[model samples]
Target: MEVDYVVVGGGSAGCVLAARLSEDPAVQVALLEAGPPDASVLIHCPAGLALLAKNGQANWGFETVPQPGLGGRRGYQPRGKVLGGSSSVNAMIYARGHHADYDAWAAEGNAGWSWDEVLPYFRKAEHNERGADAWHGSGGPLNVMDLRSPHRFGPIFVQAGMQAGFRENRDFNGAEQEGVGLFQVTHRNGERCSAAKAYLTPHLARPNLHVVTGAHATRILFDGRRAVGVAYRHERTIQSVKARREVLLSAGALLSPQLLMLSGVGPAAHLQEHGIPVLHDLPGVGRNLHDHIDVVQVVEAPHLTDLFGLSPRGIANALKGIVEWRRHRSGLLTTNFAEAGGFIKSDPAEPLPDLQLHFVIGKLMDHGRQTVWGHGYSCHVCLLRPRSRGSLLLASKDPLAPPRIDPNFLADADDLRRLVRGFRVMRDILAQPVLAAFRGREQAASAAAVSDEQVERFIRGHADTIYHPVGSCRMGSGPLDVVDAQLRVHGMQGLRVVDASIMPSIVGGNTNAPVIMIGEKAADLVKAAREPVHATREAVAA
Candidate 1:
């Protein structure tokens, strides 16, 4: 097959790229996805997110190597393989991060990426249910709305934070991101409004836009130094498709680099070691891996209603909740689990909030791998800007084989110290008057420890990822840069990466909203270069 563009991986970014590029009636776009279509009932239901952690229908359940910093525990990395990617399976929080984060990108020679410049894209992609404001936009594809009916315990969390001396922030995406509040989600009414549901689904009828799911991209087909096509495996059959204009890799932070290495476009020494021929030899293709290294303080709250647990009464309530949700779309099932949270500084002297919190009305441990029974609440306190960095390397030359993931979490002592502080602060918040009504037994590994030394030990023994990973294929203008200011891969032509993988650093909040913004910005760049590329398509097309 041939098209003006071929976007590999029909995840969040690929969905946007295929939809936006095909807006022009003259352009033909093809989106290839390794996973099945996002048609599961579990994906659309906000409460179904928990079930997905165990169901592998639309998730890439990848695990990290035993980390020395994490006490030799393999951290779980669950990335979405379906249409909207992680956005489809995440908590549905709509956080753009602090203004300083984007400015940091601009400060690093990445022009047009400062907070002021990127705010328009954020507005452009949002259709806030609260209506348009100075910081928000309406009539856009992505729906950002207030939860229809939050759980009973959600407000208690906010009230508790306020009672603990934290200010109430009506909007985290608004003026300041330094206070506690109930998070606004990327939902419409009660269902999940993923990128596919907002952008791609509405345009699937367009003849120019075609999507092929269950197709695993094996390698990029390059003609000399320019990317021209992609070779993929579909239903045990190898297929090749040509891209007339450009090839965008939107597989995500983990797989994007792995695909590049498979295509012979990554580190020279690493690729050569695996007996793969070299293409572009970009050394930074798989470097700079980072994420929100989070530690949770779990507390039993048997008094809270509509909370998830495994008691006989809790089981009955859950069954009743299914009926309530299906009948009116209003119940505990409508919640995003992380219904309330906030961003704050562990230290007052810091520039921005180095710590982020998500108040979950359930016992979430080991990335949902260990399900403890009984009603409870969890506060996720994550180090927003962790000092430690990790890398992604290929396990073998097989595209089907998973990559060797080494998050190297908590490799820095400062990260451990900050987390210790965050735990202390979160514990104070949970013990406030409002939450005191429901607070119960503590569940953290450091529950009995109060000293700094004990806290650090608990962090190393228990802290894990909040499912936000980025920077493997970073955007910049340096030796370590993979993509440039426009997200065009450095030292390469007719190729670009439009995903969370290009973040020079992880954003200060959840990654889904920022990744959608990256897609919106990348769409503009792709269209801006359309004329020149279109004129030269014949030469590049096979």
Candidate 2:
């Protein structure tokens, strides 16, 4: 098969790219996904996400090598495997990150990526329920709505934050990020508005667009220095397709770099070690990996609300919840566990808030992988920025082999210091009078202790990633930079990486919204700069 453009990965960014690129009825586009179509209720119902990590149906449940910083324990990295990608399985909170984040990208010599320049793209992709404002948008493909029914404790968490001396702001994605409030979600009529549902599904029937699920792209076919096609495995058969214009890599941070390295575009020595001859000896293909390392503090709560301990009565309550949700669609089933959260400064001296908090109305331990028999609200206190760096390297020459992921969590001393302080602040907020009615003993004994040395030790043993991984294929002019400001892979032709991997730094909050914005901008980049292609150059190898 052949097309004008071949897009790898029908993920968050890929969905946007395929939809927007195919908008030009004159062009043809193909989107390849390794997983089956997203048709399960586990992906649509907001509460069904409670079973996400265990439900292997739509996730690439990749585990990392044991990190020394995390007490030699391997960390879990669950990425979306189905259509719409992580957006379909995530908490549904819509966060674009701080303005300073994008400003820093521009300051790092990446043009056309400043907050001012990127805000327009953000607006272009959003259909915010709040209507059009200077900061928000309408009439876009993606839907952003206020949660129809947040858990009862969502407001209590905010009030407790206020009582603990934090400001209560309505919008975290507003002028300033430091405040506690109810989070706005990316949902429509209580169902998840995944990228596929918003973008790809609407355009799938267009004659110019083609979507192939369960097709795994194994390599990008390069004629010398220019990419011309791709080889993929579909239904246990190896097939090749040539691109007339370009091959856009949107395989995400983990797999995008993996695919590049597989195609011999990564570190030359590393590729040689795996017995793969080098194509492009880019030193930065799989470096600068980092994430929001966080510690979850679960506090057993008093029986003052629906979020409480496990018992016979709790079982009855859950049954009633099911009936209520199925009938009205206005019950707890519509709740995204992380219904309330905000940003804060661990130290007042810092210019901006570096600490972000997520209040889950259930006992969440180890990304909800650990089952503790009880209902207790959890607080996730993660440092917004960390100074540690990690790497991704191919384990072998096989295209299906897992890549080695070393996030090197908490390798920096400053990260641990800030997290310890944030933990104390979290305890303070929970102790506030507004939450006294529900506040119970800390699940982790002495979780409120402030001894610097002890806190540091506790953080070292307790902290894990909050799942926001980026900078593995960062954008910059440095020697290790992988892509340019326009998201074109440096030194590579007829190819671009339009995904979270191109992020120079991880955004301050969730990655779903920012990735969608990247896709929107990337489509414009291609549409504006696209030129007539020479048909004779088309080449496909299987």
Candidate 3:
């Protein structure tokens, strides 16, 4: 099969790219996804994230190599394997990070990505239910709205933050990003509006747009240094799709770089080690890996049946919530689990908020993979900008094998120091009088820690990724950069990576929104690149 563009990976960015690029009837776009369709009830229902977190269906249950920073523990990394990508399985929190984050990307020699410039793309991708503002947009593909039936405990958490002397911020994607408040979500009504639902679903009928699910991309089919298409496995058969224009790799951070290396486009020596002939010899295809290293404070509040849990009462309430949600799309089933959260500074003197908080109305032990009994609440504190970096390398030359992921989390001493400060602030907020009635004894590794030293020990024991992994295929003009400002892979032609992997640095907040914006901007860049050819064709015809 051949098309104008082959979008390899029907994730957040690929969905948007396929949708936008196919908008012009003249263009043909094909989107390939490794997982099955996003038809599971677990993908649409906000509360189903808990179940999805534990079950590996539609999720790439990848694990990092043992990290010395976390006492040699192998951290779990869950990325979406289905359509809409991580946005389908994520908490749905709509955060854009701080404005300065984009500016930092531009400062790193990435032109046209400054905060002021990229804000337009962010606004362009959003369809905020609160109506259009200077900071947000309306009538766009992606829907952003407040939870239809937020857990009652959400306000209590926000109030507790305020009581703990933090300011209240109703919008994290607004004029400022440093305060505590209830988070808006990427939902339409009470259902999750994943990228596929927002962008790809609406345009599936477009004859020019083709979506192939359960097709795992194996490698790029290149002619010389120019990527021509993608070869993928479908139903135990290796099938290849040709691209007339370009091949857009949006397989996400972990797999995008892995695919590049598998296709022989990474560091020359590394490719040679795997016995693959080097294509472009780009040294930065898989370097610069990082993630938001997170630590959670779980409290056992068994009496609060309103919160999610496994107790009889909690189960009964959840059953009733299912009925209410199915009937009217409202109830506890609408909760994103992470009902309320905010961005704030670990130190008052910090220029911008260095830490982010996610107040979950349930015990999120081991990324919710571990089942804990009774009702409880938990708050997660993650160091937004870590100095530590890691890499993504091939475990084997085979594309079917998982990449060796090493986040090198907390390798920088300052990262741990900042997390320690953030932990104290979160602990204080959870202790506020507003939350005292619902608060219970601290659970897990945190319960035994008291002093700062003990807190650091607890963090090292329990901290893991909050599922935001970026970089690896960063965008810039430096020696180690993989993509240029247009997101085109350096030293290669007719190929671009449009995913979190292209992030020069991980943003300060949840990365879903920013990645969607990257898709929105990348679509324009791809179209802009095609205009000249179209113009010449028109001139010849005239």
The per-prediction CA RMSD against the true structure, in angstroms, equals: 1.9, 1.6, 3.5
Candidates 1 and 3 compared: the better one by lDDT is 3
Candidate 2, superposed: residue stretches over 4 Å from native: 302-305, 445-450, 536-539
**Number of clashes recorded per candidate:** 0, 0, 0
Question: What would the per-residue lDDT of candidate 1 be over residues 362-402, giving only the tens digit for each residue?
Answer: 98877776777778888999999998999999999999999
Query: Which residue runs of candidate 1 sit more than 4 Å off their true CA positions?
Result: 531-542
> Per-residue lDDT for 395-513 in model 2, tens only?
87788778898999988888888888898898789888877776477775446555877777777777787777888889998899998877878898888998999998888888889
Best-to-worst ranking by lDDT: 3, 1, 2
Judged by lDDT against the true structure, how good is candidate 3? 0.91
Clashing pairs in 2: none
Model 3 stretches with alpha carbons more than 4 Å out: 531-542
**lDDT tens string, model 3, 239-358?**
888787888999999999999999989999999999998888899988999999999999988888778899899889989999998999898898898989889999999999999999
Say which candidate scores most in lDDT. 3
Q: After superposition, how far is residue 13 of candidate 1 from its true place, in Å?
A: 1.2
What's the TM-score of every candidate structure? Answer: 0.97, 0.97, 0.97
**lDDT value, residue 460 of candidate 3:** 95
**TM-score of model 3 relative to the true fold?**
0.97
